[model samples]
Target: MNVTSGQEWVRGQFPRLDWLPDETLFSLCSRQHLVMGNLDPATTSTAVLGLSEKFIKHDIPCGIAALEQNGFHYWGSAESILLHHTIFSVFVPFQNKIKIEDAIITIKGDRIDSLKYRLGLVSSGFGAEHPLKACPYCMREDVDAHGIAYWHLTHQYPGVLICPRHQAWLMVSTKSRRWSGRFEWSLPTKDCLIQQASSQKLWLRPAFLNLANNVIDLAVIGRVMSLESCTVAATYRKAVLQGGRSASLLDRIEPLRRFHLFESLPEDEKSTESFMNQLIRTPRRSI
Candidate 1:
């Protein structure tokens, strides 16, 4: 029960927390905390999540039943929240059906271990740093339209450095504690922008722009269908063949030249041979 104002707790009678379009579950929970005026995070967590000590994860949060019990059921069912409010859509294109089902079952509960591994995120060589990112234009517009700035699930996707709508580089938060701290529920503001990231402009190269658009499209499409590894590899092969290239010719291309194909990738990734191989190889399962 929430200790704020010495109020008695009632099941499913919690304060109204309407869902914002494309807003993350973390952001929704954070806004609830703000509305309740709780000085301690555990107060809000116990009321909203039915847990007193659970950490709020930005990417893949668990305990959907708890959230529903606390009056967020109108936001949607457990599965609905997982697909609409979390980063699960981004992984759907790569994951198999069985894996996706297991993810749904696990996420509906309170367990967190192995979820990343099952989704292939642990092996993807990306998402090593779960930085809280926000597009400045999005923030300003959201404030104007909705009266508050909230986190968008799309902005937090791995390798998504630019805002698909604004074509502006997303600003990463400089304060780790803002998102990582047990009690902090900081929102986007110009003051939160990382110093170096604030000074930089979007990389407007054609390849960079194309990759950003394709990634956003895939994430949106993944909500309905799974693009299995075999289908993806087949598409690549078809594209190569249509371009008057063969397997042998592709194999003969020098490694540096292959690396050049992904020149827009982060420098750290280009320097890692295993990461490069993973990107180009047709994987047996999820990549």
Candidate 2:
């Protein structure tokens, strides 16, 4: 359809479409300039129409910089089946705001891609209202990394769940803003869980150990059991063990007071030690 016809349809769907043209529409339409409403008595109509003009000049550099500052990234664009029809699309967060004059110049051959106004519904309360599921490591909710929400328990994993290729320990903190933390693991296997837990006490710094204790409390109170229950503890232990003298010094200076959380320390200690022992005895580093 023509620009005016399309704008009329859009206005019918959204009453607010009457406002000044926005970047979102520009990206979607891929038209340089759009004429809204008719100026002449012969073409007068209450409905707004978008008309495509030959030269819709815009400043490029300023526009693109503005968009980048607000966390929008260039996705891609496509040409319509009809001749001279193109559509550009970008991924921008709904919560962030943008203005019209923001322009950035980019040269591709002779064509220029200009930044316009921002679009998208407000996502302020979107993920906030929902309960976050604990990741396997830091026992916190998974969050978007570089735009997409990650699913793995720890940030140590490159993208999604723990890397299937590496034996890296990933951790995420509920109290911290960092997406992921990484630690080394010699031979990551099922039995290593207990070993890592036991060794954690010997290696982790007091501050991180305290952090681990807090996570344990949260897990118990929340009553949401999963690999996080074991993995969180394992991560803390692995961090301490691999952290070497720096971690050991912290542990020595700040000994943890006994908490009545677990009923039997001896039994717990033995079980964890035995598990670790088996892991150390095994000879395999298969990812």
Q: Could you give the C-alpha RMSD of every candidate to the true structure, in order shown?
A: 5.5, 22.4
**Residue 44's lDDT in candidate 2:** 17
The residue-by-residue lDDT of candidate 1 on 1-287, one tens digit each, is 35742443444355687887789888888898888888887787777777644555667777777876566678788878887888778778877889889988888777776788767676655553466788889998999899999888888776566787887777777654345445466677788776324324433434444556776787787788887676677676566557544333333332212222233333343344344344446776433
Cα lDDT of model 2 by residue, 1-287, tens digit: 99977765654453221111112222222211123333442221111111112212211111222222222223222111010111111111111222211211221112233222221211321111111112233222212222212222111211111222232233322312223222111111222232223233443344433444444343333222222223444665575577552334433323321222221222344454554444334333320
Question: Candidate 1, after superposition: displacement of residue 3 in Å?
Answer: 14
Q: Which candidate gets the maximum TM-score versus the true structure?
A: 1
> TM-score per candidate, in order?
0.78, 0.17
Report lDDT (CA) for all predictions: 0.68, 0.26
Worst 10 residues of 1 by lDDT: 252-261
Query: What lDDT is reached at residue 68 by model 2?
Result: 22
